[model samples]
Target: MDPVDSSAKSTPGSNGSNSASSLPGVASPPERSNSQSNKPSHIAAHRQSFAENQRYPPPSPHAHRHPSFTQQAIQDLLINPPSNRHANTRYAGRDWRDMALSELVPDEAKWADLDTSVEEATMTLLKNNTSNVVLIRKTSDSKTAISTFDPSDLNAYLLVVVGLAKPNEEHVAAYDEISKKAQSQTPISLREIQTLSRKEQLVVLPADSTLDGAIEAFGSGIHRILVTNQSREVTGVLNQLRLLEFFWNEAANFPVIDRLYGSLLRDLQIGTQQIIAINADAPLADALSLMSNEGLTSVAVVDHGLNVVGNISTADVRHLTNTTSLPLLKSSCMHFISVILSERGVERGRDSFPVFYVNPYSTLAHTVAKLVATNSHRMWVVESASPSPSAPATPLLQASHPVPTPAAAAAVGATSPPAPTILIPPTTSTSGPQSPLPGQSIAVVPSAALPGSRISGRLTGVVSLTDILNLFAKSSGLNPSDPSEQRARRRRSSSSSVRPTIEGGRTSVDIRR
Candidate 1:
């Protein structure tokens, strides 16, 4: 991982032979046409001057194109920064891509004893405003070993208790039974939690490990990693969201990366269109089951016309940790999402819960900002159903009449009486990993609109923090898709492992299958 030589100069020969390919780690350019040789010397030189700047077309969707950041590309970028970059910003000389993980501050580690009751753990989550708690075994004197648990675990536990207690007097009896169990001080066992929903693997890394290394770990399906000190004591927790936020906050310091912020998400090939979603009218229990079965953090909530209204996330399950909210499981998915949003508003001292979505044409910088602003892990991709296919689609936020915030809706209610309709082409079928693909039909108006808001779009796809981190890793000249190779190379190149063992042993976990 040497910095590329920015001073090198090379010319493409008359036959279009790329001289720069002779340099170490540079790929050969594609062949050129004979017509280029017919041009005048000045024009030919002018064309050749920008030859190395041209990028190869991205691989086809089915093509097995291994991602590689060539030295030549790095050199070109260093020599000439992208035109979109902010001109007054000064370069820091050192590449932020190679910045150590310890440089970026992480949230303080939160833990609970394994013997702690489920009710107590719920209180920890609420009080700390954290989504998860690490459970550790404890003796009379000290704590040992660790396992992760979150709101989803509580939901899973309640589902089991409620299902078994069903119809002794309808769901009411089951609800009461769950309430009684929730109030009990029964210990949360590691064995029982392990048997429940598949948990996201938690790994440990030394505080000195590079941010790019963490990116590789996350790309390999790890949700978070614990940062440990010299004594192997857990100091803080680092996750994809925090890592992304760090990059966004310091974009100007890293001019090389800052220039890429303006690229459209579609052009960057950064998101997935294969969305897993639930109908708004379906029972909340079904959505929970879908998430646990699919090992997902959240699922999009779509209306009958397949238009996205909101989402159901495991994080939202925290609101249901209490006995009072347990019965929400039997409620419609839409109502359940509404309840979660309302509760979140109360906690945050605001009543604004707008739908989170992005258009395909959104800039990567804008997408990351939205994720950080909303404190969300994923954004639903929504697209307008325009009457003319060739016409440009304007994003909801960029429109002349932007969707009003909750507070402003009342002020403008008189002028705009009719609700703005969110249009989606009618679909006779559904689409998702667990459902059939949707078929095209005539445009259909949404019947179940979101309460107190006017916004319109059809759900098209999803993009997550992991996808964004993978892009960061790739841009930093690390291939995140192959974590093993990256780790192996890192080990061979460095004197020791990222987490070196001292008097206390290095603590790390690799539970990914």
Candidate 2:
């Protein structure tokens, strides 16, 4: 196959070209001091001779008064560019000129053997501050077992899997029911939690793979990919969040719109239209149900007045699941949140749950920096004032509430005005949250709180890895309005073609290498 043309044409100012005078809209640069002309005649003559002897012919006298050929060429390319003959070969080969996966993957990656239980594996992930674990399954005889296990093994001993304490809704619900039924019984075994061994396939690439390949892998839709050695031994794992973080860190290098620098959290379309939040008084079961039904990884916990109190996430849930005395699914979310916060020394009056958040008017750069610094997947985009004390708190989703259909939401005006929809895999049911009761409101609360008083600010929306990726897509010229470009963007954003499957009460993520 012909090598892919990965070259990117540099813009005028980008290539150390002081072509301000040649640019269409830019003002010409100030004239240099004539003191240089006072240099010795010998030095001036030597410089002139050097310029004349250069391989390229000297510019015409009119070049100083008009656009140079190079500038005109650039303008022509910008106005009506030549089609790339090798457009089809964009990702045909691994030639990511300067960027590499090594620049993205962290140095301290955690590894585990197949014998490691889910609890141990999750703790390892938490300790290592990573979202994934590399599973090394030893094999004495490669041929027979490799064929018996998976045809695509490629003699690799290591595999990667996300650290989910409970892989699926079914498992969580079943475990909850069992725990409640047998309250006096012994705790569940650690083995009950799904481990890396359960995953059907692993996404792996050689350590020297290009960032373009990594981007392609992530765009294909898998959450993370494992870097392997020549022997197929795991080296590190690159997560979707990390990829976004990398992009944010290197945003200056990428082609970005001028408006991006001036854009704020509110300016960019981010977060859910209606923030799907839960009452602190609600049962943990309710939170889990909402998460499963809404296809959310985290949910805000609010007070009686719809003021934000705390946040609960998959990580919190995972830790809760491992405890010997797992809280009853019906237990209050506040109790769980309080316990977690206390354990982490996350005092009240401070930011609840150490959750990172930003004001609506905050710049995109500030938001991106916060996300990177916190190593967080999402940040709450909050307002400057808390909900009024007199106002009733937002209604929490109840088991009794029927899932709302689009018609119902439209009739009640519970839904926000429709925005540009990104084509991610459907996370929630076809019929999502129900319309609020006639007078019900969706008031938010401060993500952070003061000890004695209600804090200013209300939760508005969230900016997540998904949103950042969408922004990157738009800024990079993948027009969201174009169907072909949209499809290409989606194809490049996901790492997996097949979604995770649940079988025999265990969820197995199928990742393609």
Candidate 3:
């Protein structure tokens, strides 16, 4: 098929170029998957200690048994003192940590010792509104009173001083070491992102394409869609959310259908923004900024002609650099890739190359589930000739791929790795015929630069978030052998291959390479 013609223009309804950025529940109709796991109220492995034990115990080991004594010991001792013991029961009125000093020591005056009975000490404390026994003990020969609670710090009425006494120096050092270790333990990248890439094919649908028509063309249970022009260029993004917005807000408020749909489309304009682009020379920082800001799970990479040479997404960048430290921010956007798309061109990539493709229409629900299962934001929409989109939405259907359980994960090892979604499929054409992998940068180019630019020859890979992070942000020491590591690993890499299955949907993802 001809490479994506970025020059194709969008209609007025699109966000700018993306006209179908809509939701399902919000707008027009359609529908619906799943694992067998039941949703429980709480799924913790162990029980909670504080579930019923509501009282706070003291540091004393036997405090729980003598609860009554702990609560009212000072009261009894003060009211009725022993003959020989010094009655200082008034000291129990409140702990020093919970007292207000301003109310206790107003004007310094001659203080009596706390060597009297509880009743007498209580009267003196109440008279001065002071409950501090330390005051009576400290005399002219005692140490200085430089250690005082600052009133400003007690604005909350209660002050909890943790680590009141100096902690062990060794313990403090260990704590610091632990904190440093956790912050720096990032995932490491081993595979080249360009090794995994794929493409999506979208058909031009007439405004009147029936709900069933969309399903048959794409798959059974579809939600989000990308609207394109006659030439198959992206015009807008359409999904249940956009449709729901129109259904409840825009379309609902209007009395007529024409104005309602029009208003809804205008409001959710998805075309205004330019697709994110980055050159092969840019740093890894640029890709991070785009993902963090634009929230793009995967971004398309284009060269000077606005052509889609290759796509460098989050996964690609991850595999390029090491997230364990910091991303590589070298020269221009071109120098950014953690793992470069083969620098020697497609000739050197004969044994390995990136490929692009969408999930099969028959198992889209499973594909979407995989996307959701791993928090993957990318999936391809291919121009498949198979499976008609004529069925209605079936919400009860399970959208997961038919894969064995975790117990079977071991078998994947003995078997050959599954085919991956590589942008530049393996082909022995190292001759002068010339097939250069696309310039692999994970940022979108401006719309103005797309027209007439040759993106087809830029690169041949479309990397995912996991790939990029693994390469650029990951640390060493992490396990690198995952059966699922064939290509589709995302956000985080695993030691095993995964066939993620969404509950329902038509969009399926394939990791090329």
Top candidate by lDDT: 1
Steric collisions counted per model: 1, 13, 139
lDDT of 3 by residue, 1-513 (tens): 212222122333333542122311112212211231443546433454784333542232222222324436566455333323232344333322222222222233223232322122222333432212112222344322211111111110010111111223544553343234324432111111111112122233433333333323222222234443444433333433223222222222322221222222113221111224554334445544444233344554433322233444543332221111122333233333212433322336322222322222213223223343333444332232222133311101112122222212332444543322111111222121221112222221222222232213322222232222222111221332331222222222322223232224222221211
Write down the lDDT that model 1 would get: 0.55
In candidate 1, what residue range of length 10 has the lowest lDDT sum? 435-444
Query: Which candidate achieves the best TM-score against the true structure?
Result: 1
Q: Model 2: runs farther than 4 Å from truth?
A: 1-98, 106-109, 113-115, 129-202, 216-221, 248-262, 292-295, 304-307, 318-331, 346-355, 383-460, 477-513
Q: For candidate 2, what is the lDDT?
A: 0.45
Q: By descending lDDT, how would the candidates be arranged? A: 1, 2, 3
Cα RMSD to the true fold for all candidates = 20.0, 20.3, 36.8
The regions of model 1 sitting more than 4 angstroms off are 1-91, 129-131, 135-145, 164-191, 344-349, 385-452, 482-513
lDDT of each residue in 1-513, candidate 1, tens digit only = 212223122323223333444533344445666886687888777743355554554223223322345688776565444544243233356676567777775646666666555444555554664435554445323323367666666556655554632222334554554445434533344334444544555588888877777888876556678788776766677877887876777777776667678888889987666566776667778787666554567888765445566778877665444333344566667666555554455457655455578878877877887898877889987777433222222111212222222322432455533322111111221121110001001111121222344344666667788788777777878777743333233222222223322225421211110
Candidate 1 pairs with clashing backbones: 422-456
Candidates in order have lDDT scores of 0.55, 0.45, 0.28
